[model samples]
Target: LEGADGPGLFNAAQTLRQLVTRESSKGKGSKGDKGSRGFAGVTVRDWPASPVRGITEGFYGDAWSQQERLEQLDFLGRTKQNRYLYASTDDPYRQSSHWRDPYPAAQRAEFRALAERARRNHVTLGWAVSPGQGLCFSSDEDRRALLRKVDAMRALGFGAFQLRFEDVSYSEWHCDEDARTYGSGPKAAARAQAELANAVARHLSARHPGTEPLSVMPTEFYQDGATDYRSALAEKLEQGVQIAWSGVGVVPRTITGGELADARSAFRQHPLVTMDDYPVNDYAQDRIFLGPYRGREPAVASGSAALLSNAMRQPTASRVPLFTAADYAWNPKRYDPEASWEAAIDAVAAGSGTEEAREGAREAVHALAGNDASSLLGGRESAYLRPLLAEFWAAYDAADSDKKSEVKRLRRAADQLLDAFGTMRTARERVPDALEREVRPWLRELARRGEAGEQAVKMLTAQARGDGGAAWDARLALKQLRADGPERGAVVGKGVLADFEKRALETSERWAGVRRKAFGDQTVHGGPTARPDSPAEAAVDGDPDTAYRA
Candidate 1:
């Protein structure tokens, strides 16, 4: 325990399973209705220490079997997780335009029957109906086709629907595919997206009356370009359409907290809905590289909190729904990522922590490191080697050529790590932490380099884009003041060449100097500072604004 790395934590979990489950089995517990072991008076402080709980549903539209759904639901209910947002598109009940094709009218009745079955299990089936051609208006026929699907959902007891436009049209074309095919711009796409959402909402409101409200995934417009989406469909968004916020290629676009809040405020006034979409990124949008089955390694797979926090930092006018890519297409809000991972692990464990259980723990720990490595590295530079290459873009835009060359080298390293990850993913033995210790320092170095690289790229990108160096520099300085990661401290502690870099580094060092002695001795080499002193408890708390102004 004293010398644990990612693999160590994983092995510890494995050993803990043996200790906990074997101990659990030795005692004969109260018999259940079916003679299954049952616990009596189990007191649990069960809750995610974080606010963002992820919903994961089945993959490839496959039914998760009713047993799987129930198991996940039970754990989530215990965890107080409020959102169930990922239902697979291939769900048996999912209705496309040609409903008659999948099943005859009589068999379709059975699909409707499953809707109640879903609700009875404390799950709401979010209907996924394609409203129009990619971000554009569909023919009157297709529109009616979609409406019919919505009508069926109401009859079956669905409360919400997301006009999922991501897969329907031009990959990154303006909002609507149908419209884009007809040569439309952002405004046209927005109008179509907004109109379709409103039509569905009106139908649901009238047909079901107190059913859940309606929402849609605004086109991929927010994915790139155009700061103010208003020009495209601000009016439609204002009119009550929901916009889906997703940062597809890289980190979230640098829009400030205030700007996002203001946009949400304006849209809410129009009776509009605003929601963000977060697809777990370690793989391509369509596929997730989970271990053995299509399941992901545990750590990278359990990214529900990170997604939730991305939304939480914004205005909560409405609870924004986050869905897995496919589930978002199926009923949008029925999958739970955390529950999914736990279920997968439990299934693999099979109610016991044998050798297989240890292997599962090992995989889970690997995920934790991979997911946390990006943040730990500060940016991309230090973490570009093979397994970590997914984080490569974080370093690619370096202003200095030498730094850029280093990024390429790191990417090659990441490739090797990924090869090992693939082997470890299927390995049966519980591997030791030392097996991967060779890359620990490299990962740390990446974090150090990433911090400096981020600052440099921020400045150069701004200048290249002609945003005026001084204003961007000033904004950059302020950002550094509030930023808290390994890279910032390292750059500041060691010093970087650019004056702004030097200044940011100085401020970082000074803050650390005061906060270190105040909070506790600094522990930079291993990881984030490990002390219990809150910001309010620190000496700097005496003058909050001034302390932040540093």
Candidate 2:
């Protein structure tokens, strides 16, 4: 706020649980009193390590609702994110088909409202246009169309702009003028793109004056090192125009400073902006990534001009990872992903109903994030459950190999696993409804797997007690639960939990002398069905598409 590149501020209130403290006098206190219960003044010097740290709505999926965008802006502000870029692939007004058309009145009104909300939150609204599919770069008419579109959007309060050439051709020409002005090849395309980018960026500097610099997503936005196209663009593109890259890969598992240096070398003199693609789930729409942001070196934050993370379709659900990303961007030197992760869960769960309900929501969210933590970032699925499962097996093995130990050890382990399953099964009901709606599919799957897990534990525990009758009944109930659908819907507790159920059921079926599959022919218990033919063998399916009343 002081100069062209002055310090910025982000007051992230969502993570106040991190700052929460219980104070009482130290040493030899009453058993109930932990610390002096009083507020203490503190001086916290908070600042972002990266200049531009935020998220981009650039996923290829259904466009987010206007209200969703408003919530996202608030989230960004509360998470210390200072920028939000609008670049959904599905938005036609910003695409090649309609890059020049003014937004419809209803949409224009929505954009203005979004801008005001962003301004209130101190978020700089940024927009990106993808006009590479049919743009004749050499044509004066096309250039004017783009500028006019930018002018209208600038009037609506967008503070930054980006030209996206990621989806454009490298060797083909769209028009006769483009072919004559720029020859066929990657280098020629890069030269033409540089010509346009420099002009637009220079225009922004001259006309907008104090607005943020323009950025461009090059044709090789995700590649490693220099190339004919990258070199050409690097040599010819304007110095102040930022080059946006998605690390060494489109969504690299980890971005190190060495890679950033490589990227800078490739882009030459232009300032580099890193568009990190995490959490966005268009490629795997059934799941949401709720893991902590990690595998990035500290220099990745310090070196980039701006670091923008990509978001998922579910706006509220994206906040967990986004919150951690902001923490890393704010101070990568002191970042602790696991600690930041726990804080993120508490932050998001803080809004759930009453005190008791908020506590429940926190537990539910923590359990959910643990189970759903695996992503392209590549970590163990069900990280929390893994240790519990391992403990159960170890206790069971100890009890089996030596016959004199307390069965309490085995039961205790099983109970812990069951409690974890119970949390997963009921998390949806406990969390905020807005979050519940976004994750219903995945949560239901988690519940199904949890139920199956409960039955599996019952089966094994009964076998441990030498109750053949009880073991058989538990196995049959598990079979019935499996019939209700264990393999349906979104993925949760993917490899670890499913493997436990499979191995448990297999061991149950292979029991030395227990009877299995004892069901006989069925008969109707009540006269309720309108169609007698479909009565006892049928199910009252909830899905209307598959259910016929008759």
Best by lDDT: 2
Tens-digit lDDT track of model 2 for 1-550: 1222322433634334234422221221467654444446665646678988999999997888998999999888777678999998888999989988999999999999999999887889999999888699999899989888888999999999999999898877779889898888999999999998887887788788867999999999999999999999989997788999988887789989999999899888578989999989888876789999988999999999999999998888899999999999989999998888887898788777665787899888988888889898886789989889999888866666245455878988999999998998898888778889988888888887888888888888887876767776777777777777754548887788878987887665444221233237532221243244542212233211111121
Q: How close is candidate 2 to the true structure, as a TM-score?
A: 0.88
Q: How well does candidate 1 match the true structure in TM-score terms?
A: 0.42
The global Cα lDDT (0 to 1) of model 2 is: 0.81
Candidate with the greatest TM-score versus the true structure: 2
In the order shown, the candidates' Cα RMSDs to the true structure are: 20.5, 8.5
Off by over 4 Å in 1: 1-78, 82-121, 134-142, 167-184, 224-232, 237-241, 247-259, 262-350, 353-550
lDDT of each: 0.38, 0.81
Each model's TM-score?
A: 0.42, 0.88
